[model samples]
Target: MNRRHLRWTVPAVTVFVASVVAIVLFTQVGGSAACAAGGSASYYSAGRNGMCNLGTPAEGLYAAVGRAEYAGGKACGTYLDVTGPNGTVRVQVVDLCPSCPAGKIDLGKGAFARIGALSAGIIPVTYGTTRDPQVGPLQVKLTGGTAYSALTAVLNNHGNPLSTVELQTPSGFAPMRQGEDNTWTAPSGAVTSPVTLRIADMYGHQATVAGLTLGPKDFQPTGTVLYGGPSPSPSDSPSPSTVESSAPSPAPVASAGPSSLPPAPKC
Candidate 1:
């Protein structure tokens, strides 16, 4: 009696393993965390022209979070929707309120007007991250330094709070350091003209801005918007992907003069 040879297909097994790996990676980096907290809300004008040296505050759409929610610079670009007795308003995190108690937020004049009267001074409010809010393209402002030297940058209009920032240099990608006031500084060797930037947020989403000509006052706009959705579980969604194309245009040079606005009020 002859026994038939048993055969196992290796190609099918290989394909199955690859698919599993891809799915695992995607689940690891595809979603954002949902943040909600209740606290006292107050209004301030200090960030009226924008905080953290990013730019002028978007009237009625900006806020300065306290230590509890600010989480250092991690919460810099995150948006929060605040609800009070009067109504609810959405505001971007532009600055920090050093003295603000936990769960407290300081809204700009415009933002306060939307939710409550400025005369209220302070009011009880509940705030949370906006779910999948529509945002504009990423704006990268070269705040300090010049071409051919160490440089500082501020990224605005990002849908989620950035967790890391990297610059594409002639040699390769270089990591940047986060500084006070929502600023990021490039490493020494990475400071060069006509650079590209790769920015990633806490939600595992990323975008690239190319063709940036480094200068004391240069700015670059990536013609793509970022959309960050609600929190993701380990088994949900796909891996993080780049949101936009690499459109590089000259941005207005930042002024080197001190801020003309008066000091922001403390809580």
Candidate 2:
């Protein structure tokens, strides 16, 4: 072949290859950005606990619950299929963490689980939430006084209940039993100081409240004091019969000590 012709052929092939590579790179970048900016999803473990920050609200909301598993350089868990008012979506635990009050992942309701059974605390799960996780220290609340009382946490998904609750403390993670009044009470005295509560729905989604915090002072040791319950009814509103003029004996509210997990600062 002539020298000029050979040079032209080589340069033409190089340009074509470069163009293809650029197109592929652009597609990959766009996909990644969508996944990262996407709304909330959560990951949880049977025994591990830590926070999963889902960034801001602009991201959609979802929830998921399931046995946590590990996958290609990431954490994963499955949630019960969910069908929300919007539509159906399958969520995978992409980058979230299992916060205290284990077993539940944090996610917006939109991206986790099949919708119908989202209200149940524990349900068969097959999906999970995905997000870049942020793990923080620990927080605790003590209520009733370490005698033998139950513990509870009111989870709000942006001011709504998450349908499930987790009672966590330095001792261990205990699943709270749902009570008649939207309350979750665990077997007495299973938790102590340095407790933190995290919750997720059957669909593997976390509550959307501004914050959910649990501590030693949030539970009691002897009595069946309430931890979390329905919003409130004037009929049951702290009637003198249900409440006492003086605080319970033993650990007074004043002794909870300086909590490390201060109430999550105002949003």
Candidate 3:
């Protein structure tokens, strides 16, 4: 069942109650109209592996965000709809550009080419987190796991920035700690084989995914798509991203000065 119905044309919240697990939905927020600081956009050449370390988004549109916006790894895996001289393209945050200023962004070579002239090197642009994003089903892969022991999970294609991931235990929901790479980890005996995960996004929308076994070489689809709909045309005008407890994600407001900069991400 789809959790977030983007086409509702109104702020929505739906709970997919199930007899299999106790699912509690949090205060759901509306999606972002767009998230941007309105800055110059330049292209970068990485080894193709970004600081977030995700190789590349399947759709291929991706970018390296600056410190003020990255919010440590908080911005990782989130998708942004950027509008430039040519058009709007949705790109995932895959890398970090440490030298870039607060509002500036570094698009992947291909992404930059789509928005502006590559030879131009840089172009003015507006960008923000997208709504009703097009993504594949949620994928959960065990980075490291053993029967009833400690383990780590790499979550993928979870349309929105995740707020939390907890493993179900006999006692209750055992919270999983997010690692630097953005993977979630649980300590020894916190869970057993084929565990269930209670996942929540920043917007507070939650879902329960079960039957995740201890073994899987490739990412296994959970058969759950949080939500999707005709994305409202991303805002073309430059605007400071607006964020609320429950709203579409514009990148978090950037603070002033070098002190406002987040610790440089180790690429």
Name the top TM-score candidate.
3
Per-prediction TM-score: 0.67, 0.25, 0.68
lDDT of 3 by residue, 1-267 (tens): 111111112122122111113212111112222333355677665443466545564323667777656665667667777777798766777667776665567776667777787766666676665433555557777756565557887676665667788888888888888765666887666445777898877654577889888766556767875554433344542232321111122222222213432221221
In what order do the candidates fall by lDDT, top score first?
Answer: 3, 1, 2
lDDT of each: 0.56, 0.28, 0.58
On residues 40-95, what C-alpha lDDT tens digit does candidate 2 reach at each position?
Answer: 22322211111212111212222322222222211222112222333444332222
The candidate with the higher TM-score, 1 or 2, is 1
Q: Where does the lowest 10-residue lDDT sum fall in candidate 3?
A: 1-10
Q: Model 3, 36: alpha-carbon shift in Å?
A: 6.7
Candidate 2 runs further than 4 Å off: 1-145, 157-161, 207-267
What is the TM-score (0 to 1) of candidate 2? 0.25
Clashes of 3: 6
Question: What are the RMSD figures for all models against the true structure?
Answer: 22.3, 21.0, 16.6
Query: Which stretches in model 1 have alpha-carbon errors above 4 Å?
Result: 1-37, 47-50, 143-149, 216-218, 228-267
Supply every candidate's count of residue pairs whose N, Cα or C atoms clash at under 3 angstroms.
Answer: 7, 60, 6
lDDT of 1 by residue, 1-267 (tens): 111111222345334333321110000111333233355666766522344555434453567776656665777766666676677666666677776655667776766777766665666676665433445578787744454567678887765557788978667778999875778988764455676788876555567787666654534666855443234322211122222222111121112122442221222
Which numbered prediction scores highest in lDDT against the true structure? Answer: 3
